[model samples]
Target: MRIIRTPASIYLFSISVIGLLFFTFLIKIPQHSDWIVMFALSGSILLLNYYTILIPPKGNSLSMDSSIYLASIFLFGLHSTLLVLLIYSVIFAIIQRKIAWWKHLFNFSVYSLMIICSYYAFILIDGFTGPISVKNIIPYLLSICTYFSLNLLLVGVYFVLEATENIINFFKEILKETTATYISTLVLSLVLVILMKPNHLFGLSLFTVIAFLLSLAFKQHFNLFKEISEKANKDFLTGLNNHGYFKEILEKEVTAAKENEQPLCVVIMDIDDFKKYNDLYGHIQGDHLLQEFGSLLKASSDAANYIVARYGGEEFSIIMPNTDRKTAYSFMNELRKKVNDTYYKGVEGLPYGCLSFSSGIAECEKETYSVSELLNKADQAMYAAKNQGKNLVQLYNGHSEYSVQRSLSLEKELEEAEFQLKIFLSKDVYTYRHSKRVYQYAVDFSRMLNLSVDERKTLILGALVHDIGKIEIPRDILNKKGSLDPHEWEFMKKHVTYGKDIISTNKKLEDLIPLVELHHERYDGNGYPYGLAGKSIPKLARILCVIDSFDAMTTERPYQKTKTFQEAIAELRHCSGKQFDPQFIEPFIAMIKEFETSGDEQHKEVAASIVN
Candidate 1:
């Protein structure tokens, strides 16, 4: 016969034993006596047994034994039966190690022998000591205490063994199959026993058998549910929470935040131009990139409070609770940088020589809006990033009066400027194309250097209008066929300050002024404008300097033919740390290579010309 080593089996067995003893006591009440005390005692015993079994007490078995003894003293009388029971129980426990058969036999023999011994001892003691009634009462009370104590000891041992087995099984399978099954079986058997004839021995036997079966069923069902839940929540590709489960958790967190008055921030991110990347590199490589990006997010964020989820295809979101905007921004910035730094094999010419993404962040404020509104705001911010340019971060403060007015004013101005700028660039088609190309290069190079999205956006916008200063110079001078004289060169350099002045008055475009003014500043403090060098130059200006210069050199102008991509990169390499920030040069070169091979040659060529 197979020996049951499972916790469910032990728990069921112990419960059955306790139930049987209590049932026997209930049935043995004399017909004439009030059944109320016995009924109350039975109820108390059942409750105590349930408590012990359900939440077994901590520490040694002795405490459980004492409790059992106390309960027994109220029921059975003191006699030799108690001693006999205790001795048999100890002996049976020792010998019933291997087989269930022997253990059951020991259990039966111990209880039966103790009962018989108590009856005989009570008779003998009564005859020797005094009147039967008084003498018998003391012996009967003693026997009752001993019987309960021994029963409690047996039950406690069984409970401990079952609990240990269940814990072991839980570790082994992770799914609580045995536990669920046991619970279901126990509940069903208990209900049936309560409804059945209490005096019938068959009812008692049937209850024990049914309870054991119920326990096994409960464990199996619990394991099944656990397996299903794991499959439902886990992402197959990256082993992270899937989008559906992530949303579920986010909703819960949102409700919790509302109740507790805590702030919550959500960040949504997507790989910029991922479709182009996938088209260039195959789906397998694309999948690999997604997996890598997910892993990077997981590693960078705090696992305790942050929920990182695969929001969708090539998109991910992090839900942070109890975090303010500034901290949320910093956390996202770090995550972005870490992702940009990740290396991939065979892929080059993209930002970081592998992949890059754009992000939008929104924080929940007290009384601002609902969770849905926060999510919508984050989505809008993300789209704004895509609109401004990719590979950036956009934060949504959400529906401020000042911002709404500012946005409306900027929208009108941008539309007008876009029209005029288009006309101006078309008049000299090369100028418009060149500016656009340089903007791309600047954006890519800045990302490669791990610059913040705000900085990258500034660099790209600066690059687009970097030569806007040239608009003021005569067209003949701007596209001059021969090298400029010192006087003409002086006139050309004025475009930097001119462009800066043009954007300085516009509040929306004010941030772009520093880029325009300082893009020409050299690393050695030798360039134009303020001649700021080294750390004095804004890092954004340093990135713009290399990108613009490379675009100017590689693209064709009236005075010069286009240089090869390699030639442009080599020129930038030689000037590292002197004309450009030394740190940015390698990444810049890597970005150029990535773009060139990835069929973004037109953009690269246009950038080269603008730089020159």
Candidate 2:
């Protein structure tokens, strides 16, 4: 059978075996009675120390080492061993002054004094009764008291010194040095036992051996426990944190946030169209994508208070304690763009041109709530994003009529556009693709302006079909190689009226004609058609004008060189409030700056190409 090796068990076994051997020798002593009593008492003290070490009482203030010393002192009589203990205590006290040395000294002194007084009282009683003499009684009492008092002081000092010595040695040796010191200490104690003869200093030798072995075993057990804990808490796949560990930490953070009345934000993200990618590719590629996404999350939020966890499967959760809603929303927006921009070229047939993810964010309030509630809110938001159209971000702020309407509108448009663009682009590929880019930018800028559902949908569809009239403009004029002359320029302007006329035929699209027609209208009222000025221009039209110009400036035009997204935005800003409504321009510019600063080149490029 395997022995259950523990510090206390090992120490007890050693003491038991040693005591049996000492018992045999103790019976042969000439002063058998006195020696037997001494041996028995010593054995009892050792047994008591072993019991305390194995099953220590709860709330016990004494350490195992201190208990061992106390046991040793109790076993040895004050008359014979008092001086030795006193000297050791003094030395120990001087060496270790920080471990409540004064308290130990006082306790020892009081106990020793009590023992001395008791011994004298017994002598005085004997003297008054019969054979005891008073002549030596006073001197004996004084000598015994002095001896025990000194011993108590030394014992106190030893405890202080030992504690201090351990601390100092630990710092000097470092972790690597501990093993050598332990081995050396064991070997030295064994050598000393052998040289001094265990039969002579049997009690001291046995105690030393038991203490050393027990300490070593205990240390090993603790180390094993620590190693297991670290492995259990760490995530094997992402190297961030496992789900179980994340939950534990999140609970603690949430509790802290609530107690401190601070804000805590959580973001839940999942790969968009992940199942499609998996079906198209293999599980191996899916795993690789997950790993890449995890790495990106880690790199993006390395702040001390930020935590990222792989909640499970393809979902990840981020916790930002003490972060307000606005800040958290901004962070999630940037994170969404980053996830969308992450590309894996090895995968095939992805529409967004890469692996993309949708994110939902929820912030915690001081009201009684749990971390799970926050996570659930984020999950709901993520589903909302996916439902509206994948690869977007949604902030959960409870339910609202406006939010519901917007979600429905976005869903309808996504489905319709996916089908319509396929047919339209197949006929005239350039016009179809350009219209898609314009729609995307229009939607983005509309959301940035916090437009209502009706306004956003109007802008989205109007921009998408704004150039639909080009189909009738004659291919030569539409794709003209040089600048348009007077007659051609006038004909070019006819597409707006043509687009309006076509859109007006559909009741659903009738409201969008104004937007389509006025997209060419300038902020300064210097534009074509009506020349509507300032607020007189339809809000959607004013927005479309800027986005349309931006898309044209950045895209390769028939007669103009394509400009970078930044350059196009800069040119737009130069004409803000003149060519664009000043109110919308600030938010637009802010959104552009945010996108650029996010370090997502693809998103910036996408925004620039579509808006120009």
Best by TM-score: 1
TM-score of each: 0.37, 0.36
Model 1 weakest 10-residue run by lDDT: 55-64
Backbone clash total for model 1 is 41
Candidate 1 accuracy as lDDT: 0.61
lDDT of 2 at 64: 33
Query: Which portions of model 2 show Cα errors greater than 4 Å?
Result: 1-212, 215-236, 299-302, 337-349, 400-612
TM-score between candidate 2 and the true structure:
0.36
How many clashing residue pairs appear in each of the predictions shown? 41, 14
